[model samples]
Target: MKNRKHIVICEDAKTRITINRKWCKGCEICVEFCPQKTLLMEGDKAVVRDIASCNRCMLCELRCPDFAIEVSEGTGR
Candidate 1:
């Protein structure tokens, strides 16, 4: 998952989560901390499982030790 990033925009485009695989070490912290269960571990990286289920709480981003996850407003750019 080196130098890889995945972005997902919710239905309303009000929330966007950016996962920076370069910074992520596959610790699974984000997956465990997400209140919405919006993330899942896929091998050595975290992938968005259900974008609509995400509540934009930013829990995953906040819990990521490597600062690899970010939740932003608007659509993914």
Candidate 2:
């Protein structure tokens, strides 16, 4: 199977967050650092549990040591 990818468009509709399950080691660093509590641990991977609650804060992306999370600004698909 291909690498699992979890993508969430923020409430603003301009920001997107992507969690690369293949790269995530499920360390929970991102989840703990997220000021908006937008991510959660699902089994051994991190997933976007709440998209609308996301505040465009890149803490998850910035704090992920595995480089598993990414936050971008654009009109997402």
Candidate 3:
């Protein structure tokens, strides 16, 4: 009899984030709030520079006072 190891892994799939420049104030709130440092300041706006490492924390989108950032769930971006 062979013993099988049970592995329970939470699917930490990377998701894509979209930024709406119109709503962005270039305050870099999301860039600062992201746990993964997924957002970066480009010129006067924030951009999703590290989409692969995004943990879907939603911190960026939620913390944005101007509602500039949007994120997609469950799919690999």
Candidate 4:
């Protein structure tokens, strides 16, 4: 079985973050680059530690060298 991916959506419906565990290599770049400190490394993967502080900046997605994370902006409804 494949590892489960993680998805997080901001309450204001402005930001969505998708974490593909299968592709992630636990590089910590996403966790380190997040300006809002929304992501953290747990064991060997990235997890959403705080969604409220997320600013939808997309830095995590952009900095992910393994393409394990994606950041999207929309109404979320």
Candidate 5:
């Protein structure tokens, strides 16, 4: 199967969260590390649960061992 990617733009449009379903191994590291509970597990993939609550902390991206999650700044402004 092709690698599926999920992207979420924060409410302020200042932060972007990307989740690579193919690279993810269903490990809850990102979900558990998210301080704002911004990430959740959907079946076996990590998904953005609350973009409004995201504070651009990047904990989920940093804690992901598989490098499946990425938190980026800017909205191409």
Candidate 6:
């Protein structure tokens, strides 16, 4: 008989998610507010293509005046 031991570091998967394209006004406020620099301007709107880089800070969601963004946790994608 043998016992195997393994160690792993688990990180929180909760992340900032969802972007209401129609609501977005292309103000770029969210782009500037992201401390992690997770947002980018795509065409006339801000696009959050890099979901993995997001730390769920909610800066984008909070800064959006048009209610264009929504940052939340869990697997609601």
lDDT against the true structure, each candidate:
0.76, 0.74, 0.70, 0.78, 0.76, 0.70
* Cα misplacement distance, residue 57 of candidate 1 (Å): 0.9
The estimated TM-scores of all candidates read 0.78, 0.78, 0.74, 0.78, 0.79, 0.74
Worst 10 residues of 4 by lDDT: 3-12
RMSD of 2: 3.2
Candidate 1: lDDT of 43? 93
Top-lDDT candidate index: 4
Q: For candidate 6, lDDT tens digit of each residue in 1-77?
A: 14222111112366646666666778999998899888889898787656678887777777789987777675533
Q: Which residue pairs does candidate 4 place in steric collision?
A: none
Candidates 2 and 6 compared: the better one by TM-score is 2
Q: Which residue runs of candidate 3 sit more than 4 Å off their true CA positions?
A: 1-13, 74-77
Q: What TM-score number comes out for model 1?
A: 0.78
Give the alpha carbon lDDT tens digit for every residue of 6-71 in model 1. Answer: 533333356677777677799898888888888899899898888778888888877788888888
Least accurate 10 contiguous residues by lDDT in model 5: 3-12
Runs in model 4 lying further than 4 Å from the true structure: 1-12, 74-77
lDDT of 2 at 60: 81
Q: By the lDDT metric, which is better: model 3 or model 5? A: 5
Deviation (Å) of 14 in candidate 4: 1.9
What digit string (tens of lDDT, one per residue) describes model 2 on residues 1-77? 45333433333467677666667898999888888888888798887787778877787877789987888874655
Q: Cα deviation in Å at residue 68, candidate 6?
A: 0.6
Q: How good is model 3 by TM-score?
A: 0.74
Q: How much is 47 displaced in model 1, in angstroms?
A: 0.8
The backbone clash count of each candidate, in order, is 0, 0, 0, 0, 0, 0
